[model samples]
Target chain A: MKIEKKDVEYIADLSRLELTGEEKELYSAQLGDILSWMDELNKADTSKVEPTAHILGLENVLRSDLPEPFPDREAILKLAPQRELDFIKVPKVIE
Target chain B: MNNFETVIGLEVHAQLNTATKMFCPCPQADYKAGANSAICPVCTGQPGTLPAANVKAVELGVKTGLALNCRVNEISIFARKNYFYPDLPKSYQVSQFDRPLCEAGSVEIDLKPSGSKTIRVARAHLEEDAGKSLHALGSRALDYTLVDFNRCGVPLIEIVSEPDISSADEAHAYLTELKRILQWAGVSQCDMEKGELRCDVNISLKAAAVKELGQKVEIKNLNSFKAVKDAINSEIARQTAMIERGETVAQDTRLWNEKEQKTVPMRSKEMAHDYRYFPEPDLVPLRIAAARLETAKNELGELPRARKTRFMKDFGLNNYDAGVLTSDRCLSAYFEACMKEAPPSAAEGEAKAVANLITGEFFARANELKVNPEDYLSKTISPVSLVKLAALTSAGKLSASAAKTVFAGSWGTGKTPEALMGELGLAQVSDSVQIEAWAREAIAANPDAAKDFKNGNEKALGPIVGMVMKKSGGKANPRLANEAIKKILAA
Candidate 1:
């Protein structure tokens, strides 16, 4: 489907985009061009071609019916943006 | 009373039984360990890493749908549900919207009022899971929430049911049966406590004429079955009160604040723009070949409801006992393994009584030991032992009360029930002479108690029987000993 200017703005808002009018209009046209390109691509002569979803075609990859070691507390806390003792710190929400 | 009907639907997210993460080779990991450790660039939505779909995850999704009586879609598409969250590394969750993997099935839930009712399964789709969110300073605990990426890109099968549930109880039943079926089909462990198996309920209350339906208020964060039930109950009351006050229940999501035991609005209702879903070009349509679907179907041993009924018919077990047995795949297998070892020929009531040991004594003992029975189930106990113990009680060789002691002793020492019985000299005497001799000794020693037994003070039969059992050193089965004592006293 072709992307309309209004639809682009709506999408931008959903995406939390903070754009000036000029940037919004610019992105609207760019996105519209991309959608039109996809539309053209849809018209390929290969009618028998199946759409692909996953990269690898392996089916039913499963873990053993056992629980392996979960990450330890130290390993998990290392990625926290801000940490004290061992927890991810976010802005204080409770008054 | 207002003539209103409640419409309830459920969306259950069951983590599939896969060895690897949904799109990567990271060990199908745990969520308890916080951020980044379980993550790879592919899952973290790194600038350039690509996701290779986990095919087995899709088969399980289809297999799950088939068990729920859903029709596996020929070509199912994956889409990106865009939302910005710290825990979601990609900032957009890859999901299915229009063409889900499976469609149009139903799950049968046991209704207390009626015998059984089938709730329509709207669809079940495959999706990638989000990462863990740890509240800082009890921040998320208190309001400040932080993200942990450990769970990101985990494969999940979202099973959504049609709005067929009329009450909260049916919703609860539907979740229960769905979890049991998924676990039994060897798809997922379905441990709700672990959040491996989780559920969110959508409930709306509308007047009888309001066929268009009222706004749906989705309830989330119900960890246990009891919590889910209570949330539904309280939500119904709250909705009813609002309706009575002539207020509208908005379309929004609410959290079941388990600690507070109340439902609170998580966010105001949002339009479709909230999570703008668009086709995901990274992945291709999931294909279901007829042979594969059939294979998956054959692989599914039995659904919970069907297995429960069959357990009663084939094993002569009761409904409650059968339900308990089939709640989880491993537990059911444990019961069957015990039966296989002790087959019905060896014990008349082994099937029913075996479950009692598993759900009762075994579970109780395992709890005391603080080890999950599932961890030791395959190794520690034998069905033959269970059957032998039950048979002893049945043949009047051991009393029911005595069987518990015998089982604990045998189980604790890892000795065979027969061995324990022999060593403890708990074997009951069936010999007429031996039984009579014990009874005669009891009569001579306890003349007053024996006379009371004859004079119709039937309660006095207790001490005389005790004397016979004591004379036999508690090895004699009390039932036969009592009978022998009664006969000898009468003569």
Candidate 2:
């Protein structure tokens, strides 16, 4: 699972990140150490242990049939990088 | 033809009908509200914030498994599905691994001409929805790619099926049935049109005599069932042609181009070793107490299958009628509401006629409008008005043609059936005297056709019936028209 220096460079390119030579070497070692821990996790006995998806094991959580109005409109638009007249503005996708 | 059998499996992602997203109390809003409206810091994957799993989502996951006839797991767990994309926060996703909420469920789907097949369900688990990424690669009108976190952290139930499907038709049937069950159970909208429901397809081809499978290719992002069928059929053709040419199918994730009608390799598919799934440290093991599961099962109102059977038995509907009505929970509610005050007075049988009126008239119009049965029921049409209308139609006071017009008015104005009929002056032409005159005119105009009817040509009756209908401005109750025409023609 250890990400080698060369593979890390390739992945960083795929991820569109600008990495310096020194930072790349440092991250390679750091990623390798993390992978070794994951290796330990892969070795654990999961044969008898069931995988948990969500806590509480509750079932059938549903919304009431009543449709409610959108709340806190002003608060949501504030988090956007750009906004125009109470709207979050972004690059147009379709030509 | 080279002898190669297709081995196909399906991974279905169904958005839970939960009010809030899986990881937080943020409302599960996919679109419409606004960008980032439903997102929280936990969903945005801020550094110090942790997520608390949505318990309701887990319950829905188990219920979906149970519906497919799967055994519920005593303890289920979650793992991080590591991936890096702008849409997915934290560069990873929390999902189920070796332990799933339910295992060993199977759905039996019927295919026309080919009969039936049982698809084995591998497992079902809960997961969170991802944020959306808007790509503006080739556009000058945009500065950079856009994104919306409105869908971030919405709940999802994923069902994995064994490689049991061999044909596209069977796959379509399985998905259709699965959507029906989830919708009827009040679990999910499963609306492929809205993108709330989605599917990932796995396909491979092996030599007909080969016992094992060929290289498996996973295809992603097929939204519609038609698209699934088209993609699979095209892949089978492509794989078969390749194998015939001594070329091997590459194991990878291919994106299905619905418009181009082919699968193009997005990238070489990852082996499970790549994602490196590990149990999430923040989440604990989900324990399903037997009592809780039992209570959930009890609370699950009659499922579509059971309700369909009862509609056939108790409601005196045929198999098709029962299936059509009970396939949708909302439509079924509408049907029962219409039947509530209906007086059983059919010349044939009371319940049977009542069932026919519902399955025949109401559903016919509902389908034409493409309205979800629930939305139709949620509107102003009520049982009292519906039953009163059915009684009028049964008593030969409302013609079928006129009923359609009145039914549309009932939907538009939210007016009771009687009020609409009174306002429009659409009462049936059951006055034997007035209908008899039109019947006489119709018989005389089609003298030869009438003679043909006398000569025992049963089909001639149809033309005469149409003539009488047109003569009455489509207002003649069919039953009264038939009797009046018979009496006049005999005279």
Candidate 3:
């Protein structure tokens, strides 16, 4: 599929990124090229192969449900950009 | 309005009652703790941190799926639902997308006045909970929102239903039954006040002449079951009015305003976030072993519906009594324990008596104390004590009113029913000599009532019995009083 300027703009909007007109055109072409190069996989005859999420072939890597509270929670909260008392503060989001 | 039909579907998010969060080892017990006190690097989405699935959460999800009559897929993949929100520090939520753990389930709900309908469940997928965002605190609005990560990373399962609910009452029944099942299976507490259970509603209208459904609207922020019902009704009215005015309703997301009793549009369809879902690479696919599935099925022993049916058939309880008793798992277990305390010969005969005691006096006291009836079973009143009280009332050793008095006295005192009855002077006077004298006095006082009773007006005996009970200070066995009054009138 061909990547167009509108497609690039939509992607930019979804990613919460700003793009200039020239950047949009340039990204569109670059994205088209990348897609075309990735399309080479379509030539392979792998129709019989089952799709897999991971190649490691491992499953059910789980932990028992036990509460091991991390010590020093204050250190974690200190990494916040802004703080109000014990809470992390951000601009209000009404919705 | 008569020609149009309302269609509704529900998406319920129930926080699993696991000891730890879904992915990380953070404690999930105390959401009420100080803000950000429960956070860790894994839950806060620190860079390069990986998540390990909680096995208990998976078992619970499978158990719930089996309870809902769903097929448990042997392998289910976790996906990342990408979004941008301050509450979601990961910028993407780890959830089940295309391959859910459970799918194609159905929940049966009882309709009013006695029919039943099955609401089809599309899927029940496991996910993680986001943090809490507080915009205002204690009537004071803040310029910036405060975020609490204590609730973050908590395990949640989203049960989605097909568009089968047709009315507001059906929606209410669906939620009630769903919550009951969840709680019965020990999957979640399903407490709306604690934010353990949350719901979102999708509704649409279809005209009689049109084959396609009207624009679907989603309503959110419904904190209670009543809010869910009221929101659906308000949306139905709004949509009906719009249709009557020949106006086309636009598809949008709305928030139910509890104060205004109306739904206000929160965002248009165009502004909807595109949650580009992809398989989560950090976690491996969950493969349910056959042994694990069997264990889950074993854990889900006797679902609410089955136990309710047994209560009706085995205990001779009516549908309403069975429904009330089986509504809570703890309450049902308490009832069973009371029954077990009964003698084998008297168990079946006394089942109804035990049920009445629980559904009547026990529940009434529970309400008065603002406590759960099941909570009082072992905490205050033991099952043996309650069963003995029922036996006393059944054997005519205590009158109904006297038994109620004994129950009130015995509550929270750890006193036996017989002891309370004697101490409170509320034991029934079963002696024929004493009852005959009281009956004779009552007959002498109420001559008109005695004459009417002699003339075969059985209703007139009520006054005579009332007088006898009064003379005996409510300690008279009412049945014996009635028999004495009839014998005196006959003489």
Candidate 4:
């Protein structure tokens, strides 16, 4: 796969990141290198290998459906830039 | 103008009734819980936190899949649905892609006024619920949004339907049947009120003669079944009008503006979302063991359609009555419980009578109590009491009016129907002498009607009966009063 500047820009926008002209060019080239490397890696013959979602080889890492509150809920709630009461405040998201 | 056919497909998100969220052990209990209260590092997307899948969620998914007759995939992988939203702490939702846990199950919806259609189930996949975004604060005091992450990691199963529904009514029937099945299977509560079940409707209009489909418009935020039906109908009208005006229907996302009763564009085509979906690296592929799959299939009870058919066949109920009886799983179970209390063999051919009481007065009382039939059974009236009431009404010992009184009283007070009837003096007054006196008074009060009745005006008989009922203060057995009035007019 080839990486383009517009693709990088679109990805950056989707990630909610603002990119400068220079950073966009830098990321575009960096992504191109990363993609070529991935393509080179993909060239290896592994036709019999099963597709994997996780590298840990864990098939079913699960927890019982038991609810427990986070120990430091207050600290976590305080991490948001803006909060009212218990809620994290942000710009209005109209549906 | 052209004749157009409306085609609608639905995507329903039903929150699994699991104790914990999908990827974390945070309590799913408090959607109303204080924001971030239920958050764990994994659910809130803290740095370097790993998610462990909730086993109960997958089990419920399998159960739902089997109930819907979907092929449950032994293996399914979780993927990252990448999007930027403040409500989604992870910035991407963990959902199933490509390989879903269940697929290709169809639900048969018996449409009202006649006929049935099989709606093809496209897929049902498990995912996580995003936290609620509150814009009420923006409209209230400040121009800002509030987020509650209590629902952040709650597990959800998204059931996507094939575009087989060609009319708004069919779409309604499909949702109704799907909700009932899921609810009956104990997979999810499927309550639209609390957002347990959410629907997004995709619809488009095509010329009846045209082979290809038209531009698809998605309508979202339909909170209730009626809203779903109305939204589809309104969207169909809107799209049909747009096409008739020689205008191209642009693919856009619309919100059901319930007050306006029309869909308004929420996002234009240019602002459409591009959800970059890829497998999540944090979680392993979900594997359902053979034993778990067996349990899921075995645990499913009689589904809504099967129960409805059985109710019609076994109890000799009509289609409408059977449908009403089995519409809610709780009600169907309650009816069965009532039958057990008064088994059909002992019911003296009044099994249908018990069904009538259940679908009629008992349902009304249940609604009035604002409790489901199951709760009503445990809290207010027992199945035995209900069966006895039905039996009494059937045996003519308790008049229908008296039975209705007992039914309502039983809900208000915890007393048995017979006890309530005794305490409230609502028992049918079947004393022949007392009924004769009331009838005589009724005949004397309406001399003209009596003379007309003797002259063979059967319609005049109603006035005398009405007078007798009024004289009896509505406690008189109506059938007995009618018989008494006929005898007096004959004499």
Candidate 5:
């Protein structure tokens, strides 16, 4: 599968990323190379193997439904670029 | 110029009543708390944060599916739905895409004046909720929006209904029954006012003469069931008018404006976001064991429809009364508890008596206290006390009028019916001797009426009975008082 410039532009727009013309061309070639490598990997016969979502041998890692207090309130709020009276302010977002 | 048929499909988002966020340990506390106070690094979308699924949320999703008679899948996958918004801290939601938890379920909605209609549920998928963007639209000082991550990472299940609904009333009934089922299964609170339940409606109008469907328009921000019905109704009208005017209806997203009572366009179809969905790498496939599935099915308990049918068949309650009793799970449980304690011989009568107390006086008291009936039952009243009150009214030990007084006074006081009755002097004076004395006094006082009564004037007996009731401080059972008055008059 070939990744065209338009496809890269559409993906960048979806991700809310702004890319220059040169960078868009660069990513188009880079993404196409990545896809060709994936195609090469797909050529091998792996039909007997099961599709794996996670490679780790981990399952059912869960926490009980008991709640503890959130320890760092002020620090979390300060991480935001703009803050007003314990709230994180951003550009107005209408529906 | 042409008759049209409306098609509506609803998508409902129900927040799970979990103790913490779906992927993090941040407490899902009330949003009224200080903003950012409940934030954790994982929920705040900090880099290198890994998310783990909540077992309780998955269990709740399964329970809901079983209650709706859906086919629960043994394996489901979580996918990353990538999008960008201020409220979505992670810029993507962990949601079920190709594989959902439940599928192929249907709900039965009762229609007016006739039979019930079945709405097909396409699928129900588990997802994490986004935070809310608090907008300062009308304020003069700040015109920017604020972000609150308190709601981020909360667990939710999105139920998508097929386009089987033909009218607004049927749509409303579908949502109402769905909410009741979820609440009964103890899956979610399903409270619309608290944003625990939200709905989005998709509607289109097709000419009755044609078989093809028209362009579909999506409506959002419906905070209540009534809003959903109104939005669908008005959207149908708007689309029908457009077609009549020889204009094609444009597919768009609209918001329900409660003040104007109309749906206004929020965005056009061309601006729709492309959610690039891929399998989530951080979480493993959720595998439901056969034992776990059996446990969920057993935990569903008696659903509303079956319980309502039983109340009608076994308890001999009418349709409307049974529906009112089974509407709330807590109420039905309370009634069943009362029935177990009622006298064995008069079980049907006692059940009706308890139902009346709950629907009548109990509802009124709960309204006055500004609490939900179920909450009131747990906090203010006890089922044993309620059964005893019904028993008193049934055995003729308490006058019906005095029962009302005792009900009002006993709310939240932890006083039993007997204690309240004793303190208020509401016990019935059913002694024949005392009743005869009052009847005799009334007879002697009114010589003219007494003579008329002895002359076989049965209507004249009413005044004597009234006087007897008044002399007993209105504590005499009116039926027994009437009988005693007749006996005295005949002698």
Candidate 6:
């Protein structure tokens, strides 16, 4: 599949990234080359092999439901860019 | 309206009642907790933190799926739903997509006038809850929104239903049944006020002749089931009017404005987020072993519908009474416990008596106290005491009205029904000599009523019976009072 400049622009917008016209063109070409390189795997006859979501072959890695409170919650809250009292403040997001 | 039919489906999110968050060891923060008091490295999306699934939450998801009659998939993948929001510390929410935990289930809803219809469930997928956002504090609006990460990473299961509902009432019934089943399965509390249960509605109107459906409008921010029902009705009216005017209904998302009781369109830009779902490599696939599935099945003892049927069949209760008693798990358990206290020989009469008190007086008191009947059951009145009260009423030792008085007197007093009846002078005057004296006095006071009864005007016997009951201070057994009055009038 070919990655167009519009596709790159759309992805950048979704990621909340502001890109210049030159950056969009550059990313488009770079993405297209990456896709071409990954597409080489399509040539292999892998119909017999099952699709793998994870190569670790692990399943059902779970923890019990017991709760342990994080003692230093204040430390985590201080990491935010802006904080008011106990809350993390951000630009108005009505939606 | 006649030419168009309404189609609605609901997506309900119920928070799993696990002790901890879905992926982290942080305690499940209370809704009334301080802001950001439950944050952790994994839930706050700090770098280099890994998320492990909660086994209890998965078991609950399977239990809920089984209760809804969904086929539990052996293997389900958790995918990262990419989106940007202030409430979500992690830009990507780990949820099930394409391959869900449960699929192809159906919930049977009780329609009015003694009918039932099945609503098809498309899928039920497990996901984590986002944090809460506050736009305004009290009455003051702020330029920046406040975020509380206390609710972040809470476990949730999103149940999606097919568009089989044709009216708002059916949607309401569907939600009611769904909530009952979820609560009965010990899966979640399903409390709407506490945000343990939340619902979103999808509705559209299509002409009877058209095979293709109209544009679907999604309604959000429904805080209660009434809001859900009203929003669907409002949306139906709005869509039908547009269709009648030969205008196409725009496919968009709207918010239910509770104050105005109408749905208004949200900002167009709000719909631009494209959730790019990809499998999460951090967590492995969730595979339910045979033993785990069996354990879940065993945990889900009996669903509400089956229990309702049994109550009707075994206890000989009417549909309405059985439905009320079996509505809550704790209430049904209390009812059964009361039955166990009754003698086996008088099961039928005692069961009916017990059912009446539970659905009538017990529930009334619970409502007055603003408590759940199940929660209020053993707190004041034990099952043995309640059954004793029912037995007294059934044996004619206590008049029906007097039984209610005694019940109220015994509530929270730890007093037995018999003791309360004696203390309050509520014991029925079933003695033959006492009843006869009251009956004669009643006949003497109302000679005209006595004459009417003597002339075979059976309805006139009411006043004489009322007089006997009054003279005995409502302690006279009404049935015996009727016989006593008739004997005196015949003489």
Per lDDT, the best of the predicted structures is: 3
Q: Which residue pairs collide in model 5, if any?
A: none
| Candidate 3 TM-score restricted to chain A | 0.87
lDDT of 3 by residue, B1-491 (tens): 78899999999999998999999998985756888878899999999999999999999999889999999999999999987788889988899999999999999999997899999999999999989999888799998899998888999999999999999899999999999999888899999999899999999999988899999999976879999999999999999999999999998899999999999998534345589899899999999999999998887889899999998988888898899999988889989888889887885668888898889888877887788654766665788888899999888989887887778777788899988877887788899999999999999999998888778898999998999999999888899999988887887
Instruction: Order candidates by TM-score, high to low.
Output: 6, 3, 5, 4, 1, 2
Q: Pick the TM-score winner.
A: 6
Best DockQ among the predictions, by candidate number: 6
RMSD vs true structure, all candidates: 4.7, 6.1, 2.7, 3.6, 3.4, 2.3
Model 1 CAPRI quality: incorrect
- Candidate 2: count the clashes: 10
- Prediction 2 TM-score vs. true: 0.76
Please give the range of 10 consecutive residues that has the lowest summed lDDT in model 1 chain A: A59-68
Off by over 4 Å in 2: A1-95, B137-147, B268-273, B340-352, B359-381, B395-397, B402-491
Residue B373 lDDT, candidate 6, scale 0-100: 53
Residues B61-135, candidate 5: write the lDDT tens digits: 999888887899988888999877888888889999888999999999999876899999999989999887777
Q: Which candidate, 2 or 6, would have the higher TM-score against the true structure?
A: 6
Off by over 4 Å in 4: A17-30, A41-48, A91-95, B29-31, B138-141, B267-273, B346-349, B404-452, B459-491
Tell me the RMSD of model 1 versus the true structure.
4.7
Regions more than 4 Å wrong, model 3:
B268-273, B343-349, B367-377, B408-427, B441-467, B470-474
Q: After superposition, which runs of candidate 5 have C-alpha atoms over 4 Å from their true positions?
A: A1-5, A20-52, A68-70, B268-271, B366-385, B405-437, B443-462, B483-491
Which 10 consecutive residues of model 2 chain A have the lowest summed lDDT?
A: A60-69
Candidate with the larger DockQ of 4 and 5: 4
What lDDT does each candidate get? 0.76, 0.77, 0.90, 0.84, 0.85, 0.89
**List of clashing residue pairs for candidate 2:** A51-B76, A51-B77, A51-B99, A52-B76, A52-B77, A52-B78, A53-B77, A58-B59, A59-B59, B252-B269
What docking grade does candidate 4 earn? medium
Evaluated on chain B only, candidate 6 has a TM-score of 0.93
